[model samples]
Target: MKSLICLLFLALLSSPLLAQDIFSSKNTHFSFFSSSPLEDIEAKTEKGVSAINIKTKAIYFKVPIASFQFRQKLMQEHFNQNYLESDKYPYAEFKGKVLDDADLSKDGTYQVTVEGILNLHGVDKTYKEKGTITVKGGNITAGATFNIRIADHRIDIPTIVVKNIAEVVAVTVNALYTVVNR
Candidate 1:
C-alpha cells in the first residue's frame, strides 16, 4: 500500500497541471473605433491586463472603462458620462479559453478561435472570435479584433448625436505576455 501511494504521488507531481505554465501581461493594449458619416471616433488604452494558462488553455482580460483615451476631450467625457456610464460599470472584462488546442510552448504563429463571455457596460455577452497568437522564444503575443454592438450592451444614444456614433464599434486587443515564475 505504501508503494502504491508513492506511485500516485509521483504521477501527480509529473502532471502538466502541476507545472507553472501561466503567462501574464499588465500592459495590454485595447482599442475601439467607430466610423460614421458625421465623425470617426477612436480610443485606446494600455492599462489593460491579461493572463493565459498554456496547460489549462484558460485566458482572461480586464480593462478599466475610464482608462481609454480619446483624441478629443469632450468625446471622452461623453463616452464616460453618457455612453458607457463608467462610474457605474467601472470595468470591462473577458473570461475565455483557447479552443484550438495548439501547443503554446513551441515557437510558432498560430491562428486560433477563442470563445468567452465579455462583460461591458454592465452587460455580459458570449463571443466566439478568431485571433492570432505568436509564440517566439518564450515570449507570447496575442492579437484580436472584434466588433460589439452598442445597443446589445444597453448603451443608449441620445438623438442629438445619433449620426456621430455607429451602432457597431470595432475593438482590438494586443497583449505581450511573459512567463510567470511560479
Candidate 2:
C-alpha cells in the first residue's frame, strides 16, 4: 500500500497539470502614449498580441504601429505620416522575462518587475519597470503604470513644436493572460 501511494505521488509530479503553462499571443497587450500641448494623446492597437510562458517567465509582444489610431484625425495622420513613418516602419516588439526568482503561486497578488527590449520607431531600447500580477482560478492577470521619454528612443522632437509636446509621457498597461496546459 505504501509503495502504491509513493508511485501515485511521483506520477502526479510528472504530470503536466502540476507544471506551469505559457500562454499564447491572444493573452497580451501593447500600447503607448504621447503628451503634447495640442493634447494628451493615447492609443492602443488590439490587432497585435503577445504571449507569456509561465514556467519560463518569458514574454513576447508585437504591435503594428499603423494600427494605433489616435482620436484626432489630424493627429493620427501626423503620427503615421511624420513621426512613426508607418509605411516604412510598421511595427514594435518586446521580448524578455518577468525578472529573477519570482514566485507565481495562485491565490495572491504578486508584484512583478519586467525587463525587456522595446523596439519603437525602428529603435531598440532597454527598459525596466515594476508591476503587479494576480493569480486567480488558475489564471494570471498583470498590470502596471509607467512612463517613457520619447527622446530616449531617438524620437526626434522638432524644436518648432517643443512646447506642444512634453518630453515625458505617462503610460498605463493592463494585460490578463490565461494559463495554457501542454
Best by TM-score: 1
Candidate 1 residues lying further than 4 Å off, grouped into runs, are 1-19
Instruction: State each model's CA lDDT, in order.
Output: 0.86, 0.67
Best by lDDT: 1
Measured on C-alpha atoms, candidate 2 has an lDDT of: 0.67
lDDT of 1 by residue, 1-182 (tens): 33432332232233455335777777899999999999999999998888777876788888889999999999999999999999999989888889997998889999999999999998999999999999998999999999999999999999999999999999999999987553
Positional deviation of residue 153's Cα in model 2 after best superposition, in angstroms: 1.5
lDDT (C-alpha) at residue 103 in model 1: 96
Query: Model 2 over residues 24-114: C-alpha lDDT tens digits?
Result: 4352455667667676778766655555666667666666778776788887787788777889888767666789566665567888889
